[model samples]
Target: MKNALSRGLLLSTAIVGSLSLYSLTTKVAVVTADADNAGLKLPAGFGALVVAETGARARHLAVTPQGNIYVKLNRPNKEGKGILVLHEGPTGKATITGGFGSYGGTGVYANAGYLYATSDEEVFRYKLNSKGEVTNPTQPEKIVTGLINRHQHESKSITLDKEGNIYVNIGAYSNSCQVKDRQKGSLGMPNCPILDSAGGIWQFRADKLNQTYGTGTRYATGLRNVVGLDWNSQTNQLYVMQHGRDQLHDIFPELYDTKQSAELPAECLYALKKGDNAGWPYMYYDNTQHKRMMAPEYGGDGKKVSPGNYIEPAAAYPAHTAPNALLFYTGTMFPEKYRNGAFIAFHGSWNRAPEPQKGYYVVFQPFKDGKPSGDWEVFADNFAGSSEKVATGRADHKPCGLAQGADGSLYVSDDKKGTIYRIVYNKK
Candidate 1:
């Protein structure tokens, strides 16, 4: 009786409101993951399965309301295609249905009857039909172009809000805006010219076309780089994860040891406002001290505190974790504990040498009343395949992108292997 009731619920309503018990049998439901869970360590009652494997460098992803998957490749495939569309099959695997666009970087998003994507230097959008298929697969309107991409930390991740505005990340070209970037004993350039065109987030009209880099409003400044950002509808605000600058010890040996360099500046989660300044190049958030500290490139010892009243991070995580994706959980599939919280996919680190490189997994941060509620905890792990691999900085799969399906399942993409893993909550 328990098995029968669980397998078939009538869910009666206005004839079209909910599914009849028999109607669900024909649906393309996601099957349960294997006993091994495809090599992921998720929380209890959660399971994950391999969805699809694109042979390109899948960076970020978007899923349409109808469950179609759009994956952005970091580089164009041999066929010069950048966006790969996949359709879920009956047995829970995904099939590549089609692809579009010719250039690539990061930032693929589906919203408001269009599919938006980005290259390192431009943003494009394609019209979509009611069925969620791209009407113009090859001919996308160039929304914004000529963005500053100096090839250092230059992936243009993007997100959109309800107000018809699109936000883009233009990463800094220099590690610390130094006169001789990353060189020992180098001083920061006056005023950090990089902040003018790069090192910040910009807001632009989502519907406009052919807009150049100068046309967009500089939404916020002083961020070195942000790969994962999301517009939190629950809070009606924008949030971003900034990648802290690197090589502190190599540049200022007297001020920092290698272990300190690897773990000094914290990867920050910033709840942003229109004119917010996060104080990059000039300062970094030291998680251990939980205070903003002056950067060594700007002539400060490690202990000097920043004087400016810049915005402090909403939350902080370990440095060099390389947070690559941020998603505010608004879906209903997970338990109430996850509602309105944030899930960040850390791509892991290469610079945490002598300290055991870490962070090839996903983490969950609780939220309450539009602010972070408590400490973050590791929600998923073992993408490195073993403890030995993470200790040696050899992660087999680096989770890069995240998307939520119509059914509220979470999809994570791996850039290293281009594997997409779909995580679902199922308990017997």
Candidate 2:
């Protein structure tokens, strides 16, 4: 019995030590020099490569089964209104196939034998040929139009499930539901008047084109900004990453410090269903308590929980990581453990002061039996050079979109540098 107890203690110590070592290596690291952008030097069996560099402020991406890549850019005037297509030829190089842009925003996806792209006010579809190239590019059928465009949080992220149901993210224009707008201590709408229009996810039919603003039903509500959204095939559900509201310290100095501000309100990842309400203006994710917390403007301290009202996120991240893209990994290139995990592109933080900034990298959160089982790890990094002090205020690239190629490779887009990277595991 004594030997058994000793054996147990020794095993426990070994397991803890192993986990500590992995955490130290995988946790977010600070980078400051331009050399860091040469692409991360991974473990012996893995590698990363930069596939495309068009300087187009690329935001999101969709890759067809035949290995062609489609990138969506945020610059309206330069990139125009259609989607940018890049072809990977036999030489393993990437070249622009074509540029199509009638309108511009940050939403783009490939679904149901068509390329569905969304701008500030509308969604359009283009037919594709067998080669994964856009055919009949001259014609774009408007799937949805006439959405709100108030110049704040105007991007409408689009996604589709297996059931042919389409979903669009309509972010709230108001910051913190302010009555006077961006003012501290101001009251939100008594009944959240914005619910009638924005602050929700609306559902539409994928086959229905040119549907007006009121054509769809409100599928979910209370999301401030959800630029990153995707459908999880294994779960048959839609997942969204909300870009948490900023300036917590600036808004409530009495309750928050600069460091806390950088790390307080958790950026949230939610699984949505019809009629789901994720409290946005009235509540925010508290990273410390790991729960939905009431907003200060809604009459509560930082400690007060917003119960029975807001849907809790499946997972929470540090404040201001600015998760701009979400993708479920269904690839076999990496270890078997990553088969059902999720990858998030955090564009990094801007308001977290008095310290080195974090994020601007890719993180992989593993799942087991549909539940998060391990700590999130940095799958890719060194995007903004290699110095903490330098990267705090300046960055060469901020990750905005994530996509997995049909060949099981990964694609990442950077809005800051307007670059696209294709990361594949090199069997060495």
Query: How do all models score by TM-score?
Result: 0.94, 0.87
**Per-residue alpha-carbon lDDT of candidate 2 for residues 279-331, written as tens digits (9 for 90 to 100):** 87888888777778878778757788876567878888877778999888886
Q: Kindly list the per-residue Cα lDDT of model 1 for residues 324-371, writing each as its tens digit.
A: 999998876677888899999999998778789999999999999889
* Candidate 1 residue spans exceeding 4 A from truth: 1-28
Candidate 2 regions exceeding 4 Å error are 1-37, 41-44, 77-82, 389-391
Sequence-dependent TM-score of model 1: 0.94
Clashes per candidate (backbone, < 3 Å): 0, 14
The lDDT, on a scale of 0 to 1, for candidate 1 is 0.87
